[model samples]
Target: MHDSVWKFVCLRDLQVPAPCQVAFKWIKLYGSLADGSHSYKIRNNEKHIDWMRIGAFFFDSPVAILSEKLSLPLTILNKDNVEKALESSGACVLSNIKRGIWIADLQLVRCPVCELDTCEGTMQTLEVRNIELFLCDEYQKGSWDYELIGSYTINKSVDAASGGIFDLKHIKDRAMAGVFNLKSWAGKPSDMQPKAMITFHSVAIRTNLQENQGLITKYYAMRAGFEGEVVSIRISQQLA
Candidate 1:
């Protein structure tokens, strides 16, 4: 399999909420590292929740809306049509795509170089190998809102007659935050051929339970809505 395939696999196993939190925290803490980490700040008062973080999760959401359901031809993802997407509601794409939290394992090693079929070169070659990896909240986007609501966290409890506590506990919690969706861009739909359709998988949710007094909250989801062709070219060193 290609390295990218394994990369997606590593990304798929990440647990939700925790991975989401880790991704959000990493971005908030390091997004400005290349420019200046200090330039970025976590907004939304400590008491309020952060919506930008919620938006980030929508970046590469696995969620998608079938074109058949939307009754529209598929849109494409290319340089030209992407602009049309910005103006039309034909398809929805994540905005401000940013790298999210990631975990990877890599190795550095030395190899041999050949000068001729039967001779060795005077220099050594170095190659890097990447393997066995996992990532959580690697990409996200979208906006969120804070609002008041009733929620509950399940817990094990004891049966009164049994005189023994259950292994779980059930608790109710509430809070508020704005909710947003992956929406079709606003304008006339474009006609750019796109490759394989995109959507989200291994879904999950993330939230600040402490503020909600221990409420179970879920992360909003977004899905793509477009149809077209996507082509990839690989330049080879040899003609086959």
Candidate 2:
């Protein structure tokens, strides 16, 4: 097995310079169980979600914001993207995907892998399932504004699995995007909980596969920006 690959011999057969470019988003974790209560009182006690059964959230860094489902997007990449990622490593200089930094615009593909970090609880797995990514912007009450911008639906719904947790990032021209970094350990979970902390950071990415030279040409005409505009942006793991 190649050291660069994940040691999964199944990957030796993948075709390099595969087909297209795609992106992924993984959500498979909880933020806190403090929302629920276990103490039972005659009428005061009420049933809570299964997650509320846990003692407390355990982490050493500022926890990330979880989705409404009370889960964190852990991996977020397409299967094709992963395959392209493996292919790209052949001549890598500074990017090590397994270490979580990726080059922009990998390949066109769908399917996501999820990664988990510093967590505790009755661990469970679906063993088989499908993952997806959706783009959600601002929404107002009584207005339905949403779009399933991306997804990884497969003919065969199976486990989207990954081991351990690792920080991930995307880089281009030395600018970093899609970065996940945990805070320095204040101590062990057994010692004390994470303090409320904040880190100032910036995110930059190339949305269009094209150089977007059109914007420069239309700079004066579209200063207000194109209203009711629909753009399509594609990114993959092989892309850096």
**Location of the lowest summed lDDT over 10 successive residues in candidate 1:** 162-171
| lDDT tens readout by residue for model 1, 53-153 | 11111212322211101222234223344335423632222222222322111111111222244432111101000110111121112122121211123
lDDT of each: 0.19, 0.18
The alpha-carbon deviation from the true structure for residue 62 of candidate 1, after best TM-score superposition, in angstroms, is 15
Scored against the true structure, residue 182 in model 1 reaches a CA lDDT of: 17
- What's the C-alpha lDDT at position 181 in model 1? 17
Give the alpha carbon lDDT tens digit for every residue of 1-240 in model 2.
Answer: 233332122122211121122222211101011122111211112221121111111111211111101112233233334324422432111111111111111111212222333222111111100011112121112122222322221233222111111112221112112222222312333332211111121111111121211111000000111232211111112111
Best by lDDT: 1
Name the regions of candidate 1 deviating beyond 4 angstroms.
Answer: 1-12, 15-72, 75-79, 90-94, 101-240
For each candidate in turn, the TM-score is 0.19, 0.18
